[model samples]
Target: MAITTFPMIEKCTSIDRENDIVVTDLDGTLLRGRNSFAYFALVAFDVDGVLRLLFLLLASPIAGILYYFISESAGIQVIVFATFVGMKVFDIESAARNVLPKFYSEDLHPESWRVFSSCGKTCVLTATPRIMVEPFLKDYLGTDIVLGTEIETYKGRATGFVRPPGVLVGKNKVDTLTSTFGDTQPDIGLGDRDTDIPFMTLCKEGYFVPSNLKVNAVSTKVLPKPIVFHDGRFIKKLTPLVSLLIILWIPLGFLLACVRLSVMSFLPIPLQYYAFLATGIRLIINGIPPLHIKKSKGLLFVCCHKTILDNIFLSVALDRPVPVVTYSTSRFLNIFSPIKTITLTRDRAFDASMIKKLLKQRDLTIFPEGTTSRGQFLLRFSSLFAEITNEIVPVAMETKMSMFHGTTTRGWKWMDPFFFLMNPRPTYEITFLNKLSYEFTCKSGKSSHEVANYVQKVIAETLSYECTTFTRKDKYMALDTIVKNP
Candidate 1:
């Protein structure tokens, strides 16, 4: 194949990419952007709340003027200051690792990515903070090297200052590229703006990616690793305007959530469904239990956790409160006063005795996943549910929120229900799968783990979710390093 040299990336014909070294700019080059302010706003809001977000928005005007006229580095410095000053290093790192990937993956530039991803050794040179962009670039895009402006830190907190040599822009990017690759020039370079041209010239072949709104981004499925898990409070990217709207909505949203919770707490189970719709909540239920439900004295309803309110809604669906088994705490979170609670302290023998006693008298529920997930994927199930009962029914639960997420690893766990209800229209869909047949039950001579995995697979297939070996302990340990040796 022959290569056709063209001024813009749109005119490129072909290239032998297997052995070529590629260097690229981010933001406008590798991703679509008005600029990186939206990402900054997202990080600020997620890590520190609306006050931090407002600071960044207020500073944007000054930054914009400096960027267009005075200096790009100066403008970015202001953004770095407003968003990161006085914040813990771990919080920013956590947001970068967990929150930014989904948004960044959605904005990939089609033309730039096709050429950038095909090369042997790929490097991304950007003005965005290295800590902020490295995880997405390495994990999702498979970049080999990342060179970006380095932030200054003191006592494990951001000082809102950059290290000496300052932001990587103009000539700094060229210098960084040469230092990393040494004497051998890169085979190709891709960039989107005039500032990027300095670094692009260092490569043998350079392509310009002009701003193109008509082009669609590549699908997330094409990434090197599928993003199975992510954490954040906001449901969408927080632009300056969007951030403002959220701040204004919170007071009214809080009042509305209180009304919704009150309805669930005081109203009859039959009337709760109608009352939810009247107050802007949407509940979609599917699949009644097998007819064998009539004979149920000890039905074990197992599900992947979605929220604290899950059992409350499960109770509503069953027309009575269901005591939920929890390992974390003894408290059962239910709106109805009649709802009962069972706390398992992770002692197999004691919990087994307690659970066996209840099964003889009534039907109860268990979140075999052990922790709440966003519902796009099912975490590994605990085999204890399978071992404890022969009467297990898998239930699939999913929630959709327009404004805020109801679950978080960092924020207040108790406030999850309030945050969920605060959404403009919060929706939950509950699907009950068929009961485990005698052949698949533990009573049928299968191992407990085998039975649990089967239940996970069934619920995952029903919800169109990918099943993972990750558990609640793995989740906390990954994010917070809370469980050091787990």
Candidate 2:
């Protein structure tokens, strides 16, 4: 009954489709090689899949070790069903409709569809849950019979348990099949793993799908590396030191900035000791290593904004208290903040006059992205800043955190800095590019918008991120709509 070779079917095979029943494994056989459970979690749950996968990985070892003491069937049932504990049936159905088509197009076996179409009665039987596979089978593939693990549900949510005849693996699979179709056997069975042999043995013919036929799961490829955290006891011990740094450096940094502004009123070099101290505090708390490629005065620094923390890190990386030009909405807030900034009104003439005054004092920094992002991509650069100066320095900035993200479309601007400080450990990386002068802009006849786009592209490429035309206003509007609907 065992057919080890994958027979090449150039056209429709000579098998009798009118009377014979076809049984196939969904995961490794009909679907290209991938973990069916993992794929289901990712396609259905999105970001939540990371946590689910991590939980499974961590729990699996413990479950395996406990198997020697407990029944192996119980351990498998507990481990497999735990993932669906709180999920709603309706949500799973909706997600299946959205994700299954893409999955099928990308990972379905090249020849399985033809075999499926020609079968008289086709059945998908796998260790995967019946609820998860039935929709795709009945709606898309036009198959009625699906024999798989059954998840117990209460009301609308999963009860984190499987019904009797749990996890169709090994002998349990044979028993379940025998109970369902007594005195009958499949005409053909296809499977990819040794575990599938039990049910496949009952078929008149069996085909072993090679492991190579399985495609790599794209979700696993793009999955982020797991975050390891300091032990709670160790974090507790460092809490006092962290508190001391925040309490001492914040006010000290502000006072130092004020003194530098007062000294700049009369002297040439603005005292940047406060900026250095603030950077030190940030480094100590977050343990971010600042790498400076270029540090020079009087160069305009164009950067991507992720959070208010970007200003502090850039000042440290550049080794200067760079005066920032910000949108006028946060003018009053900046007055009370530690950093020195010039708030720009929407009026072009007013902004031009302020920029002229600021440039005379020292190096100026502007976030042409205009709004804070999640550090995954760059927003469209406003051309207004590029027109202000010819000696432009493009600075690419990125921030990483294991726990919290300090980004908002509709939150108090002043609170963003506090969010960074509150995070247990946040890292910021800044890369300074070669200063873009008039020569770079001269190619497009010194078009400010073109120059701005050029700089934006440089930063986006350096950070390995995509560029978008989304703005601060668009972000807030989207957020507002989500809140209203949600």
Candidate 3:
């Protein structure tokens, strides 16, 4: 048996020359072992990109079936281009600029980089939209001959329709390469997947990257994993001792919650601290340190929602029992929980009055996102609370679990907390930001929506997560039917 590696180019060639064409696929061949569109969607954290990814995840099964009859390029075009519908070209370009450098620095394959930089007439032939690929290719990589899928735009916004030639997958890649190069085959071709075979055949030399080889060669700062939901399943491989520990912790947690609730009225702070210690959860604070502002009255804490256990973690980290304001529908959780909270119904007038009253007594916390999220992004903040208060504090929260997720969209309220405590050591980090200054708000014209969006952006930036306009309703609608037996 003999061992072999990819052909390595040592010297550079003039890319401007027409005869020196070197075509490469973008996703796995040029970058890491991932799709460029998927990587961009995760890193950019743009609302449209996230929603587009969701649409693709949902429609992939249908697209898979359609692949049998139609061209793979057409199927990919239908699934991917739909995300760009109505997205402004300027917005997409801006997002691309922000993420491309990080991608090139962190996710580019070392072997591919050696091949791409050595060739002068490099053409990126990919199924990813040209709108995303061109900016990176021209501005960052210094190669502009990209033959990617063209997205039709109307009035400077994406129409979500792929142009006539369709996606550059399979035979479409060869067709586009021939049309551009005109009977002259590429000098070299590099691809990772079987779909790239068509274009590879048109080259004098072709290299297929090994599947098992580690592709991404990041030399810069580590990027955060994109916030995507995965279904929760019971650990079938858990040791007997671990399983017994998890089972024992459930009843113990219920007993502790009851004890905390019993004394919460008279000894609220002590009870909260006690419950936190009993759970054995840890805190790993970062970004901004948790501080207890002396002025509790008339203060509004706008925080990102992650789990039902968020209040417990916040109370432990801040060393104070902060009252939380939640939706009326979620009031049932309060029946057993120890934290002090105010429940608000849909009535705008009544809710405002109640929140104002609560703020007058003590510091109040509101999850402006209005529901729990995966903690990788901040959902759209409802402006109702912003309009009611001038003194606002932004809080960014993240939860880490080793065994099981304590919080999920599908889990029932009663059992969610138990699932959280069952983990050997579930940790939470809470960062408290300075109060939103009145002077800054006044300069921005002091609109409630503006204030809400500003705070949302601050939290998103602090956590290195995406800020999105997607709401709780959007989350439930997208995920409700898809996830099963969580």
Candidate 4:
């Protein structure tokens, strides 16, 4: 059958909001990418580590040749095999839920979104696996259905192979669409490349998305909600070259981490800043100058936690060693920590009494959020700090690492500080706000929870972050729900 060429995607305006059924391709049409290698690298690293990412990088040349020179299906299969093979099914789905949406929500194509978002009934057809792209499409994009390639899994792991209709490219996509929709053809179809062309032809109307590099990403305000939390150790978008650099630099990075920790252990507080500067670690301190506070009960510094090093960076800002009450850090971290650390047992009364006693000796720091947050967000604050002392200083912290993040809930906790120090020039910004008013204090007849929420709000506003009631337990619960429900 001979068919005529359709108009370009720019013509796909005036979409019906009530009843139009739009079937759009994923990678290039919906997302601004010629391929999905970056996303594959993300899943690879998120699931295993740099070693798994290195494995995928080593195989990309093979995948590239198969995809560009030969069949797209064969190319996608090779890439899929490298990324998914031997990985636990639970891990893949977990990344799909927690990690992928944040990236996917950022990569939406403007023109495709203009048409795709208008329709009430929408379907995303992609060569990527269904489990991977489905959560983002259905939950974030409001798609009614998502048809993607099925990965073959055995027992509880991916077998690195696609199920029967294989890699959903070219003719396979058309067949799948036909099987799913039958005689009732979709009203609008959007696609990018030649493979997408086949499936687009099956729709009543087809539109082409050209490879244009000038297109800007749609504003993030269009999203249902901002990404408050995300999982992964990567500090930047992973490319093949970046992955190679990480694999090559791990040995030196590890050694660097050790040297930094060693210096922090013995170096005097004032000289530590210069020492860090010499080692290519940056600590950017802004806001008002630190006030001199001498009290029997030391000043309580409240913070929204970003990483394990929050207390360390907070002390750096004040140019003095401050004792901290920790939550889930290993004994190794506590033993070798430069300053004092007292582990909390989560017992409200016992922990409160411990912190109160510790504060009386000298200046003490506390991260009331309990756990670290990866983005510009503050978890619910524990109010015990407010009740202890009215002399409180709220500190807002932001960390930028080009290589690796310092915090992880799923991996080894002790290695977190090491990963943070291993970066080429990790940047930390500390913003100190004025001390809290006595009127908002527990001594003013206000409840402890009220003080906690007030402090959380001040820090959130200072950082321009939205407040979430989610605590550390809420984070783990969300991750657990992914495996159980998926």
Instruction: Report the lDDT tens digits of candidate 1 across residue range 133-205.
Output: 9989998888999999999999999999998678999899988988899999998888877788888889998
Q: Model 4: number of clashes?
A: 0
Backbone N/Cα/C clashes per model:
0, 1, 2, 0
- What ordering of candidates by lDDT runs from best to worst? 1, 4, 3, 2
Model 4, residue 324: distance off in Å is 0.7
Compared with the true structure, model 1 gives a TM-score of 0.92
lDDT of 4 by residue, 1-486 (tens): 212266888887754556889998888888877668888999998888888898899899999999889988898999999999999998999888777887888778898888888887899888999989987888778789999999999999999999989988889999999999999899888887777778887888899887554688777788766656676677676778877888889999999888888777778877888888888889998784545642224678888888777777777767877777766555555666677777788787888788777777887778888777777677889887877788788888888888888876665667788899899888889898888888988989999999999999998998898788998778777655422110
Residue range 439-465, candidate 2, lDDT tens digits: 677443778878888899989988898
Which of candidates 2 and 3 is the stronger one according to TM-score?
3
Q: Global lDDT for candidate 2?
A: 0.60
| Best by the lDDT measure | 1
Cα deviation of 464, candidate 1, in Å: 1.5
Computed on alpha carbons, the lDDT of every model, listed in order, comes to 0.84, 0.60, 0.65, 0.81
Question: Least accurate stretch of 10 residues (summed lDDT) in model 3?
Answer: 1-10
TM-score-best of 3 and 4: 4
lDDT of 3 by residue, 346-425 (tens): 78889989998887888888888887776367789998877777878888888777655565554355556666655566
